[model samples]
Target: MRTPLAAVGLVALGVCLMANPLFLPVAVGEPDPAYTHTVQPVGADAVAGLDSPAAEARNGSDLDAVVAYDDLDPAARAAFDRARDAPEGGFGVEDPDERVDSLAYPTDPRLGDGLLIVERDGERYELWTRTVERESDVVLVQRVLVQPIAFLAGFLAVVAGAAVALRGRLGGE
Candidate 1:
């Protein structure tokens, strides 16, 4: 009874996941706003171009530049590759080493993209950001969805497969 119920629940959950998947948070290639907004000398001028990106990059923050995802271990490198090969909207991949292991797919844009498991060496602490540098008006946004509709078909297959296996093992319902 429990097994059957669990299988049914999985199907329902998969359906919900298809319609309204989670909206993940992401950062892009840009300097920190606080640092960018800081008042600093521009070239030789104290106030000229002070509110520019050059000032932000010179704000003395190590994180001033976007993460170098390609320069990581083989495991991380694989994730970055899958992201690069992903479709226009991006795709997801299962990385056991990632923070969640399953939602480890990195979504990359046409220009460039990178991902870093900033915490615990896993993709869970995802700092989803783009590698391309665009104007402030441009925004790169992508979400992770692992074959939303296909999950439903897979769930059905599991349920049928389980029922058959259980029937053969138990000889009856």
Candidate 2:
């Protein structure tokens, strides 16, 4: 009984080691600064995009994909175009680590990809949202949830294995 239990524990341990739950790749490739945008605080009541047509049109996009200019509503497209026309307005540096007056950079110059200037509660903000390569859903789940659970299970099995091997010496029937 103890031998079989020990074998099971060994197998579980091997599975855990092979899974490598510690280093899971969530986002792939080097993070580009072009996609890195400043989310500066415009005002306390800057909730313009919460229910606006522009926000509605931008729904259901893949995490890796940016909202295309054509996909936005007329109002959004106009704002986008206007923002693209003059890409000099700086994103205010609020943090000590942030550089002063960081300008917006487009991912694709021909596509007119760049920051979107928005005014809410009479305050302005420059938004050049992040776009990066991310791992698939299956791999994400395996790394985040499944692997950790398996590792824990393997650890528990090892403990059980030791207990089983020591049962006779520990005065258990």
Candidate 3:
């Protein structure tokens, strides 16, 4: 009886762990809301202006702009590479004057028709009129499902083994 109870307790603990795994809190740096909200463009043409040569000289280019990690695809990757190689974080926008030192990917991203937001080093940059080369729903779903099932299965197996051991020990008369 005690052995069975112990097994049940172990199983319950395992279930709880599966339900809510331990996670560390992420430290988000201070966001430059002024730049994220005010300076960024709100339309398609404004986005294109950033990509032109004249714009690039000013640290402006749609390609050099920041984007969310999730929204990134092949084209985005190529753009990122081009931007990374650019003189000043790709936008051609200079630091201090524009107050933007290096363009980077956002910690969180929201995407819409011809628009996306990139959060980097606690500031958000907006990009417009761009294209994505690929999308991966399957990969995203797989990432979501795998963790819980794996934990639950491992927990159940351990509980079953403990219960069997207890039964054998008690049965010895």
- TM-score of each candidate structure, all chains considered together: 0.24, 0.38, 0.29
lDDT of 3 by residue, 1-173 (tens): 66666666676766665554443122234322222211253333544344446556866444444565555665554544455455554443212244222333333433443345554455454553221222244533434665566576757866775776577587932
Per-residue lDDT over 76-111 for candidate 2, one digit per residue giving the tens place of the 0 to 100 score:
444344444555532322233442233334443211
Alpha carbon lDDT of each predicted model:
0.39, 0.47, 0.46
Kindly indicate the candidate among 1 and 3 with the higher TM-score. Answer: 3
Better of 1 and 2 by TM-score: 2
Residue 69 miss distance in model 3 (angstroms):
26
* Leading candidate by TM-score: 2
Ranking according to lDDT, highest score first: 2, 3, 1
User: Whole-model lDDT, candidate 3?
Assistant: 0.46
Off by over 4 Å in 1: 1-70, 93-173
- Relative to the true structure, candidate 3 reaches a TM of 0.29
What's the true lDDT of residue 3 in model 3?
A: 64
Q: Write the per-residue lDDT of candidate 1 for residues 54-173, one digit (tens) a residue.
A: 647768342333334445566554544554445542343222233333222233411112333332333222334332223232232333333444455656656665665576468565
Alpha carbon lDDT of residue 138, candidate 2? 66
Write down the worst ten-residue block by lDDT for model 1: 32-41
lDDT of 2: 0.47
